[model samples]
Target: MNLMETIHLHKNDFSKTERKVYDYIVQNPTAIETATITKIAELCQVSTSGILRFCQVLGYKGYKDFRFDMLHYLHQEHVEVNSENLFDELTSKYLSVIRQFNNIDQNKLNQLIKQIKNTKNIYVIGVHYSSLPAKHLVLGLQDLGINTYFAYDYMQASHLYNTIHEDDLLIYFSIEGNQNNVSRFFDLTNASKNTYMITLNPKPKLLIENTLILPGYTLSKQSIVDLQSIVVIFVELLLNMFHNTLKED
Candidate 1:
């Protein structure tokens, strides 16, 4: 059983404090990657000793060992899962993804929102499965009255690139940061100072002014589903901000 399933099966065994720690751990795996016991306890509004007990329940010697094992479990799970049980996997995956997002620099997301509002047009590019997120982002932006366009195919992307202006915002979505066609689109969009990209990996060969790194292994097959879910959450958050921003206008 995966970490999530294990948690579900043994949830009744956890004390209230341990349950809080468990929920926080399952929800925020990325945070667990760099978090201290103190930090986790503070975030969960529990005591440090409570967190140590939570770790012990998971069969780890201590918090450090538990975190190490959790990371390894997530890494292994990412590689082994296929599309068959992807939905169930995502249940746990999204909890972790949202935790990562919660840890992101809100100031940076605010800056990106400012850039979006100032841009003349927004172009979103993705190919194949990655296009699923691109379309979702475009719809969210459009619903908020932002002018946005998305390209699902290389040919259409090239045509759209021709109309892109220096003031336009370019957002690229790809699970793997290195797709030939998506790379080409990045190269074309590089001429625009407003270009931005979102991918599982923040590091990309093609230069962009801004990048949103969602934690997960891009090379993993399960990563795409996880990334797509993250994108949906991001869109919802962006839309909320857009609505608030418009109200002030």
Candidate 2:
């Protein structure tokens, strides 16, 4: 089990001091990535020994080992599985997903922007409900004067993928991330080809190396609507950020 899972499974067994430390760790996982044991102890209002015992209880050798595992856990995307407020849940979900982007490596985003600017051509692809957001992104990119192509179906996308070259880029969107055509496209493209996948699923089936897993509400049939509602905002951010960066250059 991961650190979060371990915490959840055994939190009730914790002593008062340990519970304080565990709660702080759960709420501020990102902070722990750079935090010293002394600093964490201060934040949790506990002694350093208390923190060490907490780590031991969680099956780690020491605080450093626990901190390392927590840092690694933060790398994987997470999604909320429950919501109490139905009326505002869509907005809440989008806000949570967008917050995840704050932790994204700025260098990685800059590299993608540079690749997009340097590409010979750009193609956007998505399957089923994912196509809606993909189309929205293509239109926004086109509005910014980027030459963008989009393929809405498997046959059309296969034909377009054939023409893709080294300098070309493919930006794919998928809520589920396991579309048959998407898998095929990955097979056809060279490892050197520029590709980015923006997925709404936390535990996507595709599991490609180049993927951004965004959190989204997937509780029921209306979940697709939830995704569509907020993806445009993200697409707008990407297009405008690229446009502004180009002008600065």
Candidate 3:
């Protein structure tokens, strides 16, 4: 279940103080995107500790982690509409997503970026709808003069896989992270030390070695619109970082 569904499923299990916090969260999710624990407590008429406990009840490490999840959730929900006058709402949600991006561990992202940059060639694989981001990533990297290829067809993907070596990089994108094609791509890339995988599947068991796990958001039951927005933003930021590092060097 996604974060929103999980919260709703266990709503009745919350204590009175927790219920107040929960209600506040449900009502002002966007506000919570940038809200402090003190602010949340004040808004909910509870103590800061009570807010922490509320987050712990939801399986987060603490209030900060809970806020991150909430921000992701709010962004996922608000970014899909085609409203004209909703620019303010969209801007707020966009800023919230960027804030989450900013909070990503710099050391980890720098390591991933270095891995990508140092590789002789990069192959990005994604199947079905997940292929959207893979293609975007390749184009973004290419614009920065990186050697990148995006494989969408099975035959081309297979050919690309056969050519991959230790000096090359493989970046896989899978929303569910369980598709047969995605698994096969991982198996092929597993022999190469430079392989990395990104997916929305949050299950720990689904993670593979050498993967840089990024959280994915689901906007609708039938579409991965939110995940697409996330992938675009992430790839753009990564490309900018890569370019900036090159200039610095």
Candidate 4:
């Protein structure tokens, strides 16, 4: 259920401080995305604990979880097509994603690639829309003669753990990084040696063991089309870098 429904169902049960948080969120749903817990508390004249309690009452983990859910909710609600030069806007947005990728930490990329090169088994998994990119990446790795596998479903993906070893790697692809199923899967297979994630979420909901995070688009301007292209490009560069390192050695 969405936060609105949850709030409505439990509105009467809210404490005085929680009431303030509920009222503020109802009045300014858009503002909550970027607002810190402290800012929200100050605005409502309540403590941080109040905000936490409010989120908990609404069935969220904490303020951060509430923020992530609210951000996605607001985005879905506010999807608008700008009639002013559609082509130009799309082009600009796509370029912006690439520019964001260019600024990624080279050291982190190098380290991640090094892990990929040495890993005997590479398992790629993504949920919903993220699967498109995950498929592309797995195919590219296979072309390079890597033993890559893409998980089509949670059950099929879980089978990998039976043969999982210390030199194996799991690359998780997520757009928002808030899938409950994905988190559960990660927990069930926590014994994996290296867990890497490529995600647009700045703050992931789940933290897997030995996880290497590669952060992607910060803004939500790009559509799925743009996102797929950006992801493919990122993986292409990773493959090139891996090849270059091998050639140099």
Candidate 5:
């Protein structure tokens, strides 16, 4: 279930302080994407420990866990796919996008592959539909015995920033490339050089240096296109390529 549903089910059992946290969260859902626990506590006029108790009351380990789930819930609020007889249209779009995949910047992809091969740890990040590719990459990396962590984004006090080394890699999977959120993510790493972004946006803003632009159709409001499916195919093929290249002798 989504975060709001979980909150609703447990709201009645919340303490007075917890209700304050909930009210602020519902009023500013997107702010939680990058808000720290301390910031939230101040905004809700509650103690930091109060926020922790609120998260625990909602069955989360803590505020970090709650924020991650909250971001997932926010991203879920999008237009659903329609099952119309636009098979021909969708097929044509898919073909067009697939052909564009052939034009992927090999130089950048090679650099990305090298980074993945050399890094001891990898953090795969994405929000909304882009999470599909992030998750696919995470599982594929694990099959190759690589250490991978899948997260919507970095959180305060999360290990993503604390244990990240210079040799580590941070690969972002974003469909449109959220500039502000992604820029902050990069800043959190102290402007790490071992960063890469795989995105469909032709002109993504605040993109990392190693970004590789891939072919994709942006899902528009009420559109009958399934662009994410094409990205999945591309990521799967990319993973297969990685498997072939990085597997042990």
Candidate 6:
């Protein structure tokens, strides 16, 4: 989470004295990014130690870590997910999906952007309904100046998976999370910490920490119906943040 999100999430956890500091920071987000702890303490009418305690209450070791995340919050684009005046079930469902993606831990989104920025090579794989979303992500990465490899064929997936190094990043865009076939399962057999999966389900039998879940309706792993259009929107959302980060740089 970014500094603002962390404070908002834990606002009530702060002591009464700390709330003064909270109110100041909330009212002056941009100013807080540039202010030192002592200056913030003066502005909030609290002692320097009180400001230190306030940062610690928000899980920061000190003011420097807090300022760094606050600067990130200042530089990034603010997202507004609009889903008003909708009556249809499909629209309602899609709005819910978008809100879920919007509410994903922002720190992870920031870290995912960093992972893309730092990785030397990225191999993205998908199949069935997920092929287009995978390609969409690959193209987005390529647009951001990352050397990304795209794979939809089983042989290509296998080749990428086998040749993937510890430094290389592997991305999977799967609607069902788990594989629908033995060949695909074989291709994903070596998913590591460097692998990231964006999917509707987390039952992929891989490292859960790297899995980014989304909301969608599905009947089976190989169901005929595809809800991957929402996946495209999700990819676009991510690409927007990545593109914004690029502009910030």
TM-score of 5: 0.58
Off by over 4 Å in 2: 1-85, 179-191, 217-226
lDDT winner between candidates 3 and 5: 5
TM-score of each: 0.64, 0.64, 0.62, 0.60, 0.58, 0.58
Clashes of each: 0, 0, 0, 0, 0, 0
Q: Give a tens-digit lDDT track for model 5, residues 166-228.
A: 778888777776577655544633447787877766567655777777655332222454356
RMSD of 5: 17.7
Over the full model, what C-alpha lDDT does candidate 1 score relative to the true structure?
0.71
The residue ranges of model 3 lying beyond 4 angstroms of the native Cα positions read: 1-98, 103-105, 184-192, 204-206, 215-226
lDDT of 4 by residue, 137-170 (tens): 7887898798987886666666754556667787
For model 4, the stretches where C-alpha displacement exceeds 4 angstroms are 1-84, 184-193, 209-226
lDDT of 3 by residue, 92-193 (tens): 555544544433435667877998778778889877777888888888889888888888866678777877776788887766666465445435434445
Q: lDDT scores for all predictions?
A: 0.71, 0.70, 0.69, 0.69, 0.70, 0.71
Per-residue C-alpha lDDT of model 2 across residues 150-206, encoded as one tens digit per residue: 987877887887777777888877766664556555453333537887775555666
Local lDDT at 136 for model 5: 83
Query: Looking at model 4, how many pairs of residues clash?
Result: 0
Candidate 1 per-residue C-alpha lDDT over 53-83 given as tens digits, one digit per residue, 9 for 90 to 100 = 8877777789888776766666666445688
Please report how far candidate 1 places residue 188 from its true position, in Å: 5.5
Total colliding residue pairs, candidate 3: 0
Task: TM-score winner between 2 and 3, please give it.
Answer: 2
Q: What is the lDDT of residue 49 in candidate 6?
A: 87
- Weakest 10 consecutive residues, lDDT, candidate 4? 210-219
Q: Clashing residue pairs in candidate 6, if any?
A: none
